[model samples]
Target: MSMEKISIIVSKGSLEGIYPALIMANGARAEGIEANLFFTFFGLDAVSTKRSGHVKIGAVGNPGLHLATFIGALPGVSGLMTRYMARKMDRLDIPPIPEFIEMISDTGAGLYACKAACDLFGLTKDDLVPQVKDIITVGEFYEIAEGGQIVYT
Candidate 1:
């Protein structure tokens, strides 16, 4: 049987954005689907060992945090709060970020960093996680996502 593909675009640098992509892609792969993650702009940090684990959850002065803690929490606000808590766990050396990224990649998910973004950031292929498949253009990413469901996170 031909496996269905799920393409995920990650555009944020925060732990909130990165984990969802990893979780979803890993989940898709667990179900035997072909999973691909495209990292662009700040999202490239998700696939970069140097930056992936360093993401800070914005708690202080964050509009979302203020809204969640005050004026009653939104429907999905708890999840955001959970993500913020997880960042603190990292400080305790629990479930390191690299381990999480490895867990996702080990499931056969294809990871790609945006070539344009890499150039803009002065990052080379060597700067990314060793598991990354390639540095590709947005066009190349779209070509991969053509027949699949594409999700932006």
Candidate 2:
């Protein structure tokens, strides 16, 4: 069966964790599949105007980092790795998070923030990036996701 739509649930706050959802959403849009991104829990950081740019890699306890846990926990390690990855992604022509969000939005994909998470984090609609269409409950998300595949990233 063809995928007419997709609903991506982004629940991670780390740079690495957030990129996959962004990429998948962008790719789906490029393929002419209706796409939506639901930012919940820690994932809300990716849509936070104040914190998006500062989101760092979670080096400690991240198996993909390949560094010893103690070494990964060292001060500046997460920042250093985040910069390195960002530079590499730039070289590969990947736009930064904000730009990527703009591009995806321009493609007519939906972007939403979790209302519960926003309440827990003391964030109002103004606290999120302008691209976010609305802050919604999980029930609302599921309603919108009806007839589409829901992917948790």
Candidate 3:
């Protein structure tokens, strides 16, 4: 069946965590579906003007640390892994996080921030990425997401 819209909930702040949502949202728009991104909890990082493009992968608690947990505990393994990921992304022509957000916005996707998360994180609208069209509660998001598929990542 064809969908008219899709709502993607992004709840993770880490680089690895955010990508899945971004990919899905972009994919939805690619197929002419309206897309909305709801940033809740730590997911605000991906839409924070100060944090968006600079999200880091957490090596410590990450289940897929890519190295033996013991080896991943080394002082600089996270940085190494981050660099390795950057290289891989670059080779694949993935834009930086900030640019990715811009592209999604330009493609007519709506970006929404979670009000509770903003309050919990002590952030104001100005602290959010420019692409954010509104700060909304989950209830409001639900209203907007009506008749759309909701994918939580």
What TM-score, over all chains together, does every model reach?
0.78, 0.98, 0.94
In terms of TM-score, which candidate is strongest?
A: 2
Give per-residue lDDT, candidate 2, residue 77.
Answer: 98
What are the clash counts of all predictions, listed in order? Answer: 0, 0, 0
How would you encode candidate 3's per-residue C-alpha lDDT over 79-112 as one tens digit per residue? 7888888899999988778999999999999999
lDDT of each: 0.80, 0.95, 0.89
How large is the C-alpha RMSD of every model relative to the true structure?
5.7, 0.6, 1.3
Displacement of the residue 146 alpha carbon in candidate 3, Å: 0.5
How do all the candidates rank in terms of TM-score, highest first? 2, 3, 1
Off-target runs (Cα >4 Å) in candidate 2 are none
TM-score of candidate 3 relative to the true fold: 0.94
For model 3, the run of ten residues with the poorest summed lDDT: 61-70
Question: lDDT for model 2, on a 0 to 1 scale?
Answer: 0.95
Report the lDDT tens digits of candidate 1 across residue range 1-153. 565999999998876677778778888988889999999999988778688767755443457565545433445455566566786877865465578778778888888999999999999988998888999999999998889899999
Scored against the true structure, residue 25 in model 3 reaches a CA lDDT of 86
Task: Please identify model 1 stretches exceeding 4 Å from their true place.
Answer: 1-3, 60-64, 67-84, 87-95
